[model samples]
Target: MNALKINTFIGRQYDSNFPEVITDAVPITNPLAVDKAYNILEENEGDYLYGFVSLIYNDVVIFGEEQLTECLLDTWSTFSYLLESRYDGSKHHIIFLDNYPYINTTIQENGQYYEIQLDQYQCFLVPIEPFKKELKKEFFNFVEFCKNEKLWFSEESSYRGLLETYNEIKISK
Candidate 1:
């Protein structure tokens, strides 16, 4: 297999030179998709943590291999619309997913092409409020830490930094 670097799914051209962490981490399961992030979201339902986000280039995700069964079953229209509206002349767009956050990418090996899926929940670097209400302690702490630490990014940083921080927090915990 070609050595695709295993790091946060920042935009295609992103290199992690800034402070970031990962949260709501989990292991991937689905053979056809990355279900790790979804597993965490499901387990944390009624709690504070939520789903993962993918840093996409245009409509195509740059992470790993997976079937868009969930996306098609769930947010096909929303994603399509997002592509149509937000894709523009830009070659990339970061998708902020509150739920159903998973991806699959293709690989070549042994004279054949294959797909490997990973749970993207391991991709998020911060805890997010599950509901649109006052922030919880963990959420507040993570946000405050981001602010004080100057971890926030202006252009493509939000997606990458938040996802990176999520991983850091997960490892520390």
Candidate 2:
């Protein structure tokens, strides 16, 4: 079993040496605000930030539906758009928490359609889901892939509930 352990830090400013992966976590209270601040810092540092851009992006991993929600909300500032966007079920996904139950459930239930996995996995689907046809295709493709692979994960109901609620939140435009 490749169970992962998570290290969580809560604050505005994040400074860590945790190997930029899922086991190491640094959840900023307000990441957008911090990002803006970091942009300023980068401007002051001249070309130095560019050198660290990969590391910087890798360091901040978004896990769970809530984290994704916060991210989508911050970016789109609306629920309907987020749901519609996710309809295609395609986005770059990176799981940051080690042994997070909700994430494990997502992986267990919805891993086949795209490159959904533990850390820094790529998904082929695009983020544009407004109609039933698109969603049905993407969703069924994932389901068929899972069946063919015969892959399954251990599930926790509470975690599943949280994810379902998170999905509802996204569509609750």
Candidate 3:
């Protein structure tokens, strides 16, 4: 398969120069995304980190491969929408997961894909069955992170409405 270069996404690189960061001074995830700046004492310190912002998604998500595929197609279809049917754009499905936080590789590298399906709870980077080629994935950067949040549970599609309807369906206990 031809590897496409995708610069846009949740964890896209803002610039070549990364601001100095010291992550997790204390335990537990913070409620908000953290992308702070710090002073680097020496140039060598720069080698240690790939500074980028990743959004915190603190939710109990129960999704399967079908849901994961749906998300992948949604993201890719939305991305390809700009083309207006001129050509077939890449689905840009995530290839592999290495259980890592930083997405510092390119579309041609391993772990590039992002859609992760699960039976329940928490985000993790687990390699799927295909074991295909992967792309570099950055965590949710500031801008993309905010943009994505806007798409969730809008007036046209409220979670409360869905939940209410779902509860109406009586399954015999």
Error in Å for residue 42 of model 3? 5.0
Residue-by-residue lDDT tens digits, candidate 1, 63-131: 432222222112222222222323332222223333245322212121122122234333221111111
Query: Candidate 3 residues 68-134, lDDT tens each?
Result: 1112222333222222224232333331122232122212112543333222343433232121211
Report lDDT (Cα) of residue 137, candidate 2.
34
Provide the global lDDT of candidate 2 against the true structure: 0.28
Which ten-residue region of model 3 has the weakest summed lDDT?
A: 131-140
RMSD of each: 18.2, 17.3, 16.3
**Lowest lDDT block of 10, candidate 1:** 126-135
Q: Model 3: runs farther than 4 Å from truth?
A: 1-36, 40-44, 47-58, 61-114, 117-173
> Which candidate would rank higher by TM-score, 1 or 2?
2
- lDDT score, candidate 3, position 81: 28
Per-residue error at 98 for model 3, in Å? 8.6
